[model samples]
Target chain A: MRSDVLVGAVSILFGMAYTVQTLHLPKAMVGNPWAPLFFPLALGVLLVAMGIVVLLKGLRHHPSSAKKGGSKRLIVVTILICLAYTALFERIGFIPSTILFLGGLLFAVNGAKAWIVNSLIAVTFSFGVWYVFEKIFYMNLP
Target chain B: MELIQNLLLGFSVVLTPLNLIWMVAGSILGTILGMLPGLGPTTGIALLLPLTFTMEPATALITMCAVYYGAMFGGSRSSILLNVPGDGAAVAACFDGYPMAQNGRAEAALAISAIASFIGGLIATVAFVIVAIPVARFALRFGPPEYFMLMIFALSATAAISKEALFKGFISLLVGLMISTVGIDYQTGVLRFTFGLMELQTGIDFVVVIIGVYGLGEVFKNLENIASGGGLQAIQKKFGRIWITLDDWRRSIIPILRETPVGFLVGVLPGAGATIAALMAYNNEKQLSKEPERFGTGTIEGLAAPEAANNACSVGALIPMMTLGVPGSGTTAVMLGALMILGLQPGPLLFQQHADVAWAVIASMFLGNVACAFINIPLAGLLVRVLAVPPKVLYPVIVALAFVGVYTINFSVVEFVLLILFGLVGYGMKKYKVPTAPLILAVVVGSSMEQNFRMALMLADGDFGVFFRNGICWTLFFLAIGSIAWPFLSSRIKLPWNRS
Candidate 1:
């Protein structure tokens, strides 16, 4: 349910952003009634409307199985880990950065024991995938 | 003798050490991805598409086809055991599949799906090899106006899948059309929505969007449940050998026969992808069954029908793509891109121009399906174990793999960012139950549809009714309308045959 809210907020935000961005475009001159902004503006309205409808619907239903909290923190951490991995991937290489990222996510979401076990398994699998993509398939993964 | 010789050549293609290894690897990878939540065959194929660039077209097509069949095979594995379908088509499989699992019949369920899919694929491949030539010739009769109407037919017929409001389906389609406009205009060379980024000039890579939406969004949604107390305990089940009994075969034979053609026909129609084929077949089987209420409770027919239908649909999709230059699904669209990359324009002249390549590809589907069956069948339990890998272990690996895969295409961070954004949006839309298939389909076919419409009009001096003026175009246009109308009409009047 909270996921619904977060998703709704994102939709509304993006829709508004789309609307604002398209507002700068000049209107199509009197040939085809549709302008460049016409579609975007309408889409923005529809998206905002959909978001509002979804938010309201979610509020009314109140699904009890919905998990509360923990995700926000983890999402932030996951983002940081992803950004860090992207930065580190080239220098540290695919296997190492993958180990770190997988370990970080496992620890963040499922705690440290999961982190250790998953990290080991992930490291092994990453090596296999890297071998296939990089060595066999000759994919130039940094 | 000629057919046999051609098939032998196909065997040589599949038997090559590198190609065989890739096929095995693709199935393994596809099965793993399919077992996981949120990642579907499209994501699997899209993630791996760049690998195709380096290989012979035959190897590329076979590897991708193996992955496609493997994912379809694997989709049921999770849905049966975990009640989570990695792809939408498997949702129907889960209705009965999970119940069978609960009854300690996971092996039976898995075996049935494998056999059913194998039969379906075999039927389709045979049809592809034997009938595709004449069918492609027949499809060549369609001109630009006919093509325009055919796309509309494809789009409208998809509404039949919407169990709820038809309006919602149209809304979904409208969204797809909107996304299809996100790059440079095909006619004017004017930018549509790119905010001056040079990377935007190439438009959205269909694969990236597929990865982000289907792949990333699924992870995020599953994360909440995983963090909560939603992860299951004791998924390990003891079972006898993964083989369908004679009785099981008896039950499935009729369904395979019925659904083979059903899936093929559905697959032949544009936008009615494997999921829809599977769904329709499942629904049709339920309606046909004497014990209709047995549908969601682990009926073998439930497994057999959709499994057969979806795989057959793959073959069905190729007819229009090869003959009409209109792709029926995202994977087929990518195959169309493969067609373009190989410098073989698809449409009417393709058969005359590239018969060997086209015939060889059709021939390969026969061999590929057989290879997929071998890979899937005696290995069902091992594949199901792939699902036991917890999300904590899997998500990061997939994300990293996806990122690396996308980045390696051009080594551009801008592409990565676009990939991530699409992932978030795809995830969000998926969470909200907005279907992703139409978006990609629309994008792929959009330029062609608009271009054909404009051309038809220009030929008639900008008259809108030029599309309907010709007898061929008018027949197709009405057929499109009738298809969309038939489902709604059928749903309204309870047939005399509707038992309950």
Candidate 2:
């Protein structure tokens, strides 16, 4: 469906914002007429052009379906899980949150017997990774 | 004599107990990961990169190379026994490998893949050793202007590789470049695309982007079709007696020999990685085969050619990473990231200053590939059993792993959001048939290309013609032109503007 339209439109708006921002850089300090800003500015222009193409393509692919899909409910739920995991990682810790988040995700996907298996696997994998990073590699993990 | 001395020093470092342990660990992990569906070397390396923070650069690099080469050797396991390709490079392997498995020749397929991989790796290693020193010296001659031209070439080639319409590829490349410019500008110190958000000042982490694109995107894509039924028969391929018959060896040997150099050289080129080399090798082999019709149905040559190409390409990828500091493949990109994290800037100067380290990495790759061949061939059956794991169970785990990996990078909530957003973008790009490789290549090569372009301009005193003035630069430019023109030239898409 034209689900990519809004995303492409937002991208074009961001590109415009970037182009306006690039204008403020001092060209004199940039030296040569091409300057450091040239490539970025050029990219911004191309981004807007590409965004427009994407928008048009998306619209043509689905004039009405972009806004009408209950399946997209899953997207919101997924996003929330991500946010919850992010907000909770340092507090609840990476291993706990990762296993819990994975359990929830698998459950949502109708995983049946796979949910418990996934939970165990997630706990093991996350802790295994954490142990390697923090204990062995001495990385300061969240 | 100098080479021998440096190599001996490298061997000393690589053979250290700690590094050897890391190499074995990396290879085992890599083989398992490659045996799984959807995950590739990129995910394996990226997920491991954050852990490399404490290891010495030489150890980190050798470990990463081990994983990369091990994955190449092991990816065929899934393709040969389960019909599921482990990665893009292995996609061609499925054309022949799976049928061989179904025909009860899985052992033969696995055996030929190991031999081909070993041969390809060996040839590419020799080429790497021969080419690296001279190439690093030659690349040292590049001034900012030359660097700029090279970057532009990388960017242009990346943008053009997309299977989508040129305009869409341009958009994806532009988005990457724009994302790259979001942080404080190198010259002006002007913040870009930050929109007053505090987190934006640091720019989006490359880890976040990669995890989103490769890891999370994979999860979402898998979710879209999880209900689709597929069987996971215990890889019943007879295990212990793996060996290609004389007929099998005869068919594969010639193709492996032909594909190694082709794959290696293509892989050595900046931005052309194992995936391309594998695809090109398969296509070239098919074109040359008297029984081209047997390609997709299951041919040993198809299995051998792409397997050889992937391993050759692994070695080929090291050429630019070691010589020019430009990574030709995603695994090498992570290796570059590891090097950068170690505060070791790799370039022409790197070879002169750290010959021992550079040569050690090269020497370790040689040993690692040999190690992978020995280790992987015996474990192919066990690894192929990875397909028995239901996708339903695996997808969520992959997503969780990706989330945790990115979150650990900085404990930033914003980066997590960025991961989901980029995953959606990646999913969208996939749906539209837009190639993600170009966008990634652009992102990886983005900084160098931009820096070089501006340097070139400054060196020429702002003369645009300077890009064309040098014969080498002009040749590169024309090659870019040729790359652009290639599709239309080969296809029947006649364009008036394409007239020579």
Candidate 3:
């Protein structure tokens, strides 16, 4: 699918969902017609209108460039690494998690060359920053 | 005399030993961060913000402002040497700056930018001091209706000036406004769009969003390039004298003087900042030059105008932020968030209520600009070497630091997850050519807009006509309409001079 079409479709879905949610919000008290839903409903309508325009424009025009092949894999893999790091952050503790995350990312991007240097850099940065934030700034890290 | 007294009080506050030390330290740190690829003032300020959580408001604000000024000065170094802009505002500098470096005038280019930035910052600070008091006083008369219209005008102006498609800008803005509504609605005691999550009650934190969008999102964008071993590399150059001669100074003085006010005026308009100012100033210089063809080559006017304009614009951006409580750019929006975090409300009452903090910040700008220029000129060679750090190594460290920075705020895993999610969203937005500035700005202003709207409606017993009754309100409404229509109208309206 074209990028604009995808954007428009997502936006329409979001607008509809939010509109439904807004309708469920409690109404304003007596003598007050201005409810919690007023502003969001207005925005929802604007979003739907803008979505239609974007969708039509997308359908009318073709994309100038096709998607490239390799970068998608790199981006996905990196996001997964970050997610894994975040998930294990508190469980494994800050220093170990940071070292693993940094080393993993470095190895993933640069490939497993010079294991000593990569390990050293990962260890040094994680511990060095931890020391500064913990000792100097007095910020508690998990 | 009153201005002089306040300035004296401000100087006393900033001249304290601790504040002065932080200013110098911030300048050095900001220069290093600015020279690094993918980290500008916004990211620099965001990353350093957590450290200031325990300091006095004056100290915290001055340090952050110093960082901002230093980043603006340091941005030109990478632009000149490697033809890679360290920040969006430095993009214009690359045109003439890189060519000058290629022609073996790297030192001269560096020196001129440093001097121009210094002069620009000094003049803009003076302008800021002169304008801030009156702007604040004028804003004291704004009721909720006028305030609402002003925000609308801000949103419309942002949409109009966005480099993306017009509708896309509006879409981004609306999305931000919607996201802002996710927490509990302050009025009527209703839970909004929370979907039963306990954490959603407090709304999304803007600082988390900023770190995610700028820090992690940029990391994701550069991941492929780093994988391919194609990230930024330092340009090798020898620094000789690092000073411009008399001829260079003679040519630069006029352009600097001309571009500073242009930059300042443009920057005072909400959502317009250094990037636009620099681009406009560069174009204006080209038009005024006798040899316009030499602009993209190695021209002193080309280098001086943009360098000065961007620095002036950085200071000019503070005018609205400090006085009217509206951020003129994404960086200023972050600064506003910082101010709020420090328990300071940056509106008209700020000058009256927090006069000490406000004046100290203004005075610090004067000291920060001079300090940054002095440091940058002597340390240009050292700062440029920061670019040599491999992105593969540097980015991961940045990611780690980002996680730690966000975590230090609340120590919540959920917020960390939100950071990663917004990072992905930011990456997607960048891929789709959606402007992030409008979205961030909207997020900053959405709640305030809602508060003003509700208050105005309450004051008028829910009459919509209340929005148009006042002169200021009507003026702002028309300005909003004009701004939204200007982009489409400019292309269609053929001038008489072009009727041939």
Write the residue-wise lDDT of candidate 2 on B59-137 in tens digits: 8888888888888887878888777788777877888889987877878888888889999998898888888888899
Over B1-500, each residue of candidate 3 has an lDDT whose tens digit, in order, gives: 99999999899999999999999999988887877767889889988887787789999999999999899998888899999988888988998999999999999899999999999989999999999999999999999999999889888788677423787888888988887887877777677877788988888888788888878888887886665557666477457878899999999999999999988888888766788789888988888899989989989889999999999999999998899897867788888888888898998999999999999999999999989988888878777777787777788778777887888778788888898998888888777777777787788888888888988998998899999988899998998988787767765775321221
For candidate 1, lDDT tens digit of each residue in B1-500?
Answer: 76667666556656668777777787777777676766778777877776776777667766777777778777877788788886877877877888888877777888888788878888887877776667667777776777888787766665334433243344455555556656765545557677777887766665566666656666666666666667754565455787778888898889988998988888887666787788878888888899988888888888888888977887788778777787767677666665555456777677667655565566556666666676666776666676677676677666766776677666776766766677666656655566666566666666567667766765776677877777877777787777667656766887532322
Question: Who wins the DockQ comparison?
Answer: 3
Across all candidates, what is each one's fraction of true contacts kept? 0.19, 0.46, 0.64
Candidate 2: misplaced stretches above 4 Å? A1-14, A24-36, A51-75, A110-115, B162-165, B227-240, B290-297, B493-500
Who is ahead in TM-score, 1 or 3?
Answer: 3
Interface RMSD of 1: 4.7
TM-scores, in order shown?
0.82, 0.89, 0.96
Best candidate (score: lDDT): 3
**Over all chains combined, what TM-score does candidate 3 have?**
0.96
lDDT of 2: 0.74
Ten-residue segment with the worst summed lDDT in candidate 2 chain B?
B491-500
Interface RMSD of each candidate, angstroms, one decimal: 4.7, 3.8, 2.3
DockQ-derived CAPRI band for the predicted complex in model 2: acceptable
Q: In candidate 2, residue B214 scores what lDDT?
A: 76
Clashes of 2: 4
The true-versus-predicted C-alpha distance at residue B253 of model 1, in Å, is 2.2
